[model samples]
Target: MGFTGMEAQKDEDLVTDLTGIHHVGSYARIDNLINFENNSASQLLLVGQRRITIDDVHDSDNGPLRVSISAIETPLFDKKNQMIKAYSNEIVAALREIVKMNPLFKEHMQYYSQRIDIHNPYILADFAASVTTGDGEELQSVLEELDCESRLKKALELLTKEMELSRVQQSIKEQVEEKQRILEFIAVSKLLGKVQGRIICLVGPPGVGKTSIGKSIARSLNREFYRFSVGGLSDVAEIKGHRRTYIGAMPGKVIQCLKTTQSSNPLILIDEIDKLGRGYQGDPASALLELLDPSQNTSFVDHYLDVPVDLSRVLFVCTANVTDTIPGPLLDRMELIRLSGYDGPEKVAIANQYLVPKALEKSGLKEGSEHVPPTLSLTEGSIEDLVKRYCREAGVRNLEQHIEKIFRKVALEVVENLANTSHEDQHNFTISPDKLHKYVGQPRFTSYVYLERMYDKLQPGVVMGLAWTAMGGSSLYIETTTVQTKGGKGSLVTTGQMGSVMEESTKIAHTFARHKLEQVLEPDNAFFEADLHLHVPEGATPKDGPSAGCTMVTALLSLALDK
Candidate 1:
């Protein structure tokens, strides 16, 4: 032991925190650990001369250890001791499995692999734990365990779980790749014949990849892609083309789409067809009926094309946020498919398979040759954290934004480090939960309904409800609070930007609560004199659905019960 003295008062606090079971080790303590002179703390510069153990810890009159130092037993290792030898071999084998699962550990593991004393069970256990640093609690458990067998057993269990998890991740990656191949094949072999001269309308919530699917279809067919939005378009002349008699005549959008693509069989995507409206020029929706009709379009004549033009080879696809607004006759001409947003597991898989690699390339994180690990990476826990916390969306638009945000920060750090150093070290940032906030800012928000369910602590007059929208399903909370009026007369008040449907639902809920209170509560309870104000949060967002009816009734009953 060197530099034997620890700060007199703070020594016991540090003693309690010591987790290791080592019989011989040393650490120094300083009373007021910081210093004002030269703005540096005092250093405990100990020179190790020899190893020793404290045989006795006598408290004397000083209230601290005034001990005698002695030499203790050294662990003996014999290769012939099969029990000790077996545990030692198992630890090494488990460490190798862990290394195989995690590529990031491979580079640093070579040194530890060669340095570990395989013959000594205790030494092997310690070496394996250091290489596979599982977690604080697990590491501390291994540190305090004096038995070599127990230490090796614990380390093996931790490594086994890690290896199994890695296998699942690898399997998911392969499945995603195979799915991509199958989709491409289906596009070429079947979709070409299915929608040869027909139109397709993708109906889904915004950001649900409707537009991207259109582009993907075009790529799969090896055709040029062109898109134009007909939102609020209301002129028939735009579809049939302007007559040559007009001073400035032009071809219709269909002819222009064919001309710009230069390929007669190119894909044409019409965006927001449901948004078309009436205008003085003419009804564009009516003209679209003529263009999309299979019998008329084969030799379709445009006013400006001035001749029969064949449009049967030009494939048309359309997209809309909702299908209801599309004219019934127009919608009948196309095949429609709905794309709901992804679930949690699906989002995580997509992030790993498509989003992560794309973000790495887009942010230039793998730009230089020496960026050795290739791309900035996310730890498994971090990927789960990002999905659960930062990105709770119907679409991955916000998820991609957050991922891009993380990479942009990593890019800055890499550039700054390179400028400051000799460029000898590679900058590969592997993000985990602890370091997540350093890259992306705080998560935008925690969903109110999610928090309510997680805590499972609901106050009276609060009820959960399910809702359906063009986007998808969502859960909302309906809260009813009672207010006593001055005149002993009560009128119900409703908030939450509710449409007429919700307003009527609220009134129905109020009437039911009144009848229920009459049956349950005492006849003269003060609750009858109080006005009830019902509200749903996020009032700026309009909500109107019959799905919330049952919930409103539940909330009103809770308020009446005052439970």
Candidate 2:
């Protein structure tokens, strides 16, 4: 071996400079021993002033040889080894598949593949060292493998496990980042008052929990809730407040609401906002626009106090039966959330879960009481029957009222029968579908009753129609027939307290029917010559809108063609 910068250095100091390269020939007494099983290398070499170029070495000492410095270099496998040539392509292809599964590992995979030594039967173990950098006992077993193909298999298995762990870690990092981004977005939105500051308007039929939802929001936020109705509010001063100079001057409902709640940021529910009245005093609906607008409400000025009240933090929820009567400008500032009425199944569920229990409590009918006998049993079928037969309104207000009425009667009957009847005889008072009529009187409504009553009337000149009213949806019939009047030429007469829109609809229907039936009718037919009367049933009730125009046309056509 030839060494540079070796100026009579101590043997211990030479150990520090043992990392440099050197040339060692066959003649040199160099012994570098590496135990593949131990997973460690031992190198012993003798450095001299001159390089040794002899082809053979002659050593006489057989005793243990000691060296102060050491280094080891493992040799590559023979290129002519047939196994390496046969298996190289298969291992490369498998590595390519792994790289495709993890694109980020491509550079590392290439570097490790280039470092593989064909002489090392544990070429896979050497590659895995670069890949995993782990000295695990499992990897030690792979290092001890001596077979070319078997070691390659073990190395690939180790690489697969490391890749799976890497993928899982990467996935966890991405998920945490996504959650952080969402949290930041929500924080930013709330900080800027972009979503939370808008005034929300709940539009639905009566008793649909609009006001209740407002209270729920307040309770959830740990804020106070205040509700007031403006159904017939007319004076602008009621909202903006009367001036301090006026008699009995006071702050507007907004200030009153804040004072009642005793919090600046309390939730204020404005009920019946759609029914806000407009009179000579001024429009209350118009006054509400300034109070509801998030941008303007920050510095709301009340006339009575004549001071700007910071109402930006206050949450406003307005409730209305419908949005038609609400002022357009005021409505523009609100975010509308429409709640539809509960159907039969929903009402039955609510009655069973909440309404029935509330009624029992209110009517002094204690479930499981000696006089009441067992828990107040209201089956789902019976509730469904009640919902179908007694209450058909859009809202549950009527249903709740009917349940309360039934409970009141049951309470009364139980008290009277407490003295006269035995415990077994009390079963007569147990509420069921058949006995429902006895408590609430006859069902206020019956399913398809109107349609059944009008079945015979639905003839050649009559057509069934649907109409919506303040109460609920109902069936209507349009009847068309010839009306004889002396010297009266063909004319149209509409009854049923028809409004201007309905009158216009009747005229349009008559004109359209005449045009459509022109070819079908006889040339000498008196269908158009005689006066036609279009009469809607329930003549005393006022009706409007063009919804019934199709029914009117159908009835007119039926009468004209006698079909």
Candidate 3:
């Protein structure tokens, strides 16, 4: 009768406990609540019916749970405490079962049991302090085995070392990739198109990547890049070097470059070869010819070195704005690659590919709050407009600067806009052609008038005469007029800054006209007495050449016959 009554009382207590408790839906919710409060000292009302005081909760010695209060409203505190203890014990028993079944937990438990100093009273005290009273024996055993402070310190130290090593490795990887990119850029095609002994001349306007290309090649080949400017170099000794007998003997430019690069097979860029000064000192171009020639360069003897150093393996590249100024012999040996001015399309391509991304980075907008849309790509049309109207230089150096300007302006505007907007409302931005004008100043050129003029005046007498001058090939017009005269003085009056060659051409044209007129017209009536004036427009432009002979003759004939 006593056992039956005790079992009924236990059943009634369990039923009351279950009925009053507000069940948590999931273990995840339970964990979240625990972390939310840090399991710190706080007060929680059990189902809003009973108030429970929670102390500083930590890892338990016996089990996961610590205190469980009664669900009743200030009803039966003594009975509640006993019920809580019983429930806590039940939780501890469940944990032990879990540990026994799980291989990982069992192994950890075994390791802890063997390593723990159960005999030390101080160790036992620390273990007891760390664990809660109602926790299971399995938790207590695990807690006793752990040296929390020491383990934490060791883990932190190892993580710090690993982080540092990772940073170093990343830095090294970046450096290697950068080096490889540089090498690839330089190792494109060898200048002369032949690997053997040959001189390659880089002919282009200023700032057209000539010098940069030379350097890139040297870096790519893992060789040295040497630059020597022969622009005003008048002395042959600058190239061949002064003899040892001379008081101030020094090595030539070639030897000096080799010494600087510390390699014989380095790329040597001889700049401004066309502008080599010719004076009383000696012809530097002529000396350069000896160094550049494949047949003669093998035993290139420098007077300072006093040794015939083999320059056959060395790559020689020459840069010049004009090839005509170079010595004939040297020019003959070199294979010239003409790097003409960048056209509108090429400029746009280069700007979009290399300039814009770099400019964006320079503007400090990489990770700013206002995200610049990557989809905001530079269109071919926009680039064409910019190149044609705004940037008209042969090289894109100025264009690059203008692009940077645009980026800077846009970045400022973006920053300002972002500052005005709320953080939640901010979005990615784009810069379109309509907005481009606000950033960059007005266009440099209104229109290309030269091309328009060329196409407009395409007639019989107004022929497009291409003349080669010191500047370059220029188009000029040859005009002619004939006046009937009674006097017998058959003479040609040449105007528009005519030179000796042009004057001679006029005489030739006059004679040809007279003979042709005599053959075509009646010989009795002398048409040769007429004074003829051959004039070229753009009188400010001094013109002199043998090439204008055919044009002059054609013009005079057209005027005489009125054709």
lDDT tens digits, residue span 211-237, model 2: 766665565444688888998988999
Models ranked on TM-score: 2, 1, 3
lDDT digits (tens) for residues 441-520 of candidate 1: 77665542334362268899998777777767667788888776444665789999999988998888777778887887
Assess the local accuracy of residue 91 in candidate 1 as a C-alpha lDDT between 0 and 100.
65
- Candidate numbers, best lDDT first, in rank order: 1, 2, 3
Error of 2 at 358 (Å): 1.4
Note each model's CA RMSD in angstroms. 28.5, 22.8, 26.6
Cα lDDT of model 3 by residue, 1-563, tens digit: 00011223443533223323222110111211223366665543221112233223345555433333322122222334443344334333433554543334456446545855633323332322222222233232322233333322332333333333333333323335333433332334345433454467777776567786666555434467788898988888899899899898899989988888788688888888888898897888878877888777889998888888888778787888887677777788887766656666677778877788788789876534346644445556666767777776677888888888877876776667667766524544455555557778666666643232434544444444666643324467777665555675667777899899888988887788677877766755544676767778789988787778788778766666557
* TM-score against truth, every candidate: 0.59, 0.62, 0.51
List lDDT for all candidates, in order: 0.71, 0.69, 0.60
- Native-vs-model 1 lDDT? 0.71
- Name the regions of candidate 2 deviating beyond 4 angstroms: 1-191, 194-198, 245-248, 366-371, 419-427, 446-453, 484-488
For model 1, the superposed segments whose C-alpha errors exceed 4 Å read: 1-198, 219-224, 232-238, 245-248, 367-375, 423-428, 446-456, 485-490, 515-530
Q: How many collisions per candidate?
A: 0, 2, 6
lDDT of 2: 0.69
Candidates 2 and 3, the one with greater lDDT: 2
